[model samples]
Target: MNTKNEGVISEIERYAIKDGPGIRTVVFLKGCPLKCRWCANPETQKSIYQLMYWPNRCIACKQCILECPNNALSWGNPGIQICRADCASCGACTQICNSQALTMAGQHKTADEIMQIILKDLPYYQTSGGGVTFSGGEAASQGEFLCKLAKECKKHRISTCIETCGYAKWEIFCELLPYIDYFFYDLKIIDEKDHMTYTGVSNKLILDNFSRLIQAKADVTVRIPVIPGINNTQKNVEQTIRFLLEQAPGCPVSLLPYHRLGASKYDKLDMEYTLAELAPPSEKEMFQLKEQFVSFGFPVRIGE
Candidate 1:
């Protein structure tokens, strides 16, 4: 109930195997510093709560429109239309919708409240050598809240991991280093200009933090999402290999092939996806890239 210790989160995925070493629970924190064009989890980009309306689930009930105090809901061509600008995400309509066509995407929960959910999977973590993974829009965006949760996990002797973009201040990573057992850090674009062009942020900080992490000997796996016509070229891949060879030699790499799996999420959130037409790279391309990195003596894998 203490707002000061609370953080906004998109959702939590239990029994996740890819996030960390073992069977892990991934806590998806809300908010991000980057706006990558191919971001799959569009719902987690914003820092606040959002409404997700699934028209197919609507039963033509006008109760949502009637209960909406802000007049944000209105009957439209197919079902209920939400005026996002005027909607406050109050959850009033969601509470009254019996069909469950509408739902909120984020939740405000204190670190202790989240720890309760995490502890439920303690048995799995213990048996499988997995623990909890603090994933995000970028977990470092919620530094204080993340540190608090990590602290609690440590108290319970639960191994912890963090999946991050390495965009936040170095101080935040320092705070998490003591508690985090592993890290899944993203290195989207090696070039600063291209990084800013695609993700709306410079890669200087990301690179700097990554170097620092390597120097500090943090257990990290650098992940690269191979987007076609973007960072999938030989030049970018060479640059990435060179950088990793210099900064994180012999580090493990995970190549995440681009996919349109989350394209429908944009429609549900009523947002535009700039890369809707972009196609995922072929398996051959991913394997080639992996081989390239592997040739450099860096351990590489195809998927996350």
Candidate 2:
């Protein structure tokens, strides 16, 4: 088992739907290894904590530039350039900026400290059959912290779930399986080469760990993000159906059509939105995909 202590989480989102079986408190951990082009939560991409700056919100008063000790903040026509690599997340610029443009992404908290916040919604959990879900920026990237938190949730008799890309080692998944009641595993593309082309890593480890989970009879749900012109083709869908039938016939599949909801977040993070012009799949396209999955006798959900 990997015993390294990763950084603690940044935020806990309570009463979340579409994450698991019931109403869930999603603990948003702050690190990931992959540089997925369509990543919704771009702020969580980095391994370390970061502060996001909104260019529109800035009044161009140069308050932030003056306050930054490292000279990381500079004013250009594009607004402020807070050098992410050089600037420490000291919040000095964020404090001086009155427009609420500069904001931090992560916070350090102990497992017990987080649990206290989670348990407050225990009544909702009991009523709605929801407990807690550890989501990312790939939760498995912070395996030790996730494992410890999962154990604590189980000790409280809270049904637990994890939304992961399954990109970590099998040992990491093995250590986590005991505490997780449901696994929301993302299977974006079946073809390893295609997967790597978009998600910046091979799907070999993901596929291997998923097969291991199936052998262990873990409760798993497969998710596919139906990005138009990407994985939404008939061939990709057929390949996915074939893989699922052979590997995990019992697992329910959800087809999540891509959206531009996170496009603005890219601006806030000062990162490029690669699929800026790409529109989400049409309703007709979504239903077509759903029908394809249904043809294989696989239960399908259109979104989430």
Candidate 3:
């Protein structure tokens, strides 16, 4: 039944408990508005197809060198290297790599195609109070496709949720609210200057959208990533608490401590890991930070 509403996604993780209530399947969509230094899923940030090279899996085979249409791949001093400027990401090299050393990150899928997959876990979702969660690079960025997929989920009586940066237009959210039951909204940086400095985006749109979503009474949870030497500051946390109180009084908050879980991903993508040395907060610190929000009469936890 492949309803052919094409969309690009990085991966689909099933039986994910952290995405939402009970057991859930998370569809990791591609592309995002924010460029946070400590991004856990850097591969999802790009809209186009990109390559992830796992050097450990390389068998020293030069098959990719022969398959490359642009001759973009060549043997470097250490190993095979891809010329950033010449590589077209046509997946020729990826296809020829029998060892699965190189693979494309984004996969093109249709809503109907995805629905068939979602149906496979319907029993687990129904029994465990869980369903499909549309996570992103910011799901609202692909509003039309999101709406279509969400509609399909709802039509099947499947619970749908979204994890967004809250940086898109109000119309997009409005279009999705009817179908999406839960929203895992991220509130990374509170201060305008700090937000722009770290994520390369203003906090205004995000704040306004949060306010709108709260006012609309949509099922939204504020998820904060406590990055060390960044937004975890006492002042910023207090400011964030204040903002939350104003926009979404008593809303549930989840504090996700920054970790190096995605550090290796940067190297695979041929990018630098800026926060390589930044460590996650200790249990005590995480709880102390959680108390900041809890004190404001909001139900808060250390992790989502």
Candidate 4:
């Protein structure tokens, strides 16, 4: 497959309302540059295919162990065991698993293949004033494929939104500018050190890109994941408010209270969730945060 024409993705969700202006289709492209500690979509973090196993779904059929070409599966005390090192994520075992215990997270698809799915939702998009949203682990991480898909969407007069972390090159953002109608950009932490500690990357590039977007008059909604014990502190919020006040005054802000919805996914993928004990911010907390933004003359909304 031509790399520029193909993209690895987790799923194509139809009828998504919160992601964009109206009822929409959300294309979850796989791959990311930053490893945000509080990322809700762990499966999309890696570009390659990942094997997911559910113990409850396993019937002890041992079908997977027998099907493994890499000898990566075996029986353990409670259930089947996977040697991730040996496993190539070829998905042979998942294909043969009758009990639906095993599955692969990533799918390699051509832009045309994805456009077919998007076109199917045309009636809904037209009536609801919704369009396709290119979301991801980070849509910009798959630059070429994302540009191709967004270009195709525009050709069909489909309004497009990109939900991004703002960590990619400015050139990629430039490529996407003409095709994207709106951008849901994340502004997780204001302090550069804190940002690095939590998201495994410096915020310099992110902030720089955001500033450029603001200067360019791009329609962007800044999203902050209100994770407890992270960026929820008064000091951090103040810094965030100040930065936005300086660079992106009046830009709409979306306060997304952090949730543990994807925590269980860690276990399925055999990955550790460091914030397992952390709880989501309360309604009162969200309101207070919203008030901070609103008080500064910035439009704010909680949740999506």
Best by TM-score: 4
Rank the candidate models, highest lDDT first: 4, 1, 3, 2
Which residue pairs in model 1 clash with each other? none
lDDT tens readout by residue for model 4, 179-256? 899999999998999999999999999999999998888999999999998999999999999999999899899999
Off by over 4 Å in 4: 1-3
Total clashes in model 1, counting residue pairs 3 or more apart in sequence or in different chains: 0
The lDDT for every candidate, in the order shown, is: 0.92, 0.85, 0.89, 0.93
Residue-level lDDT tens digits of model 2 in 136-175: 8888888888888888888889999988888987888999
Candidate 2 off by > 4 Å: 2-6
Give the deviation of candidate 1 from the true structure as CA RMSD. Answer: 1.9
Better of 3 and 4 by lDDT: 4
Candidate 2 clashes: the total is: 0
Number of the top lDDT candidate: 4
Q: Which stretches of model 3 miss by more than 4 angstroms?
A: 1-4
Per-candidate TM vs. native?
A: 0.97, 0.95, 0.97, 0.98
Q: Give residue 267's lDDT in candidate 4 (0 to 100).
A: 84
List model 3 lDDT by residue over 1-304, tens digit each. Answer: 1233889998988999989998998998899989999998999998889988889889998999999999989997657898878988899899899999999999999887788888999999999999999988887777788888998999999999999999998888988888999999999888899999999899899999898888888999999988988988988988998888888889999999888888998988898888888888889999888877788899987877
Between candidates 2 and 3, name the one with more favorable lDDT: 3
| Pairwise TM-score winner, candidates 3 and 4 | 4
Instruction: Tell how far residue 285 is off in model 3, in angstroms.
Output: 0.6
lDDT of 4: 0.93
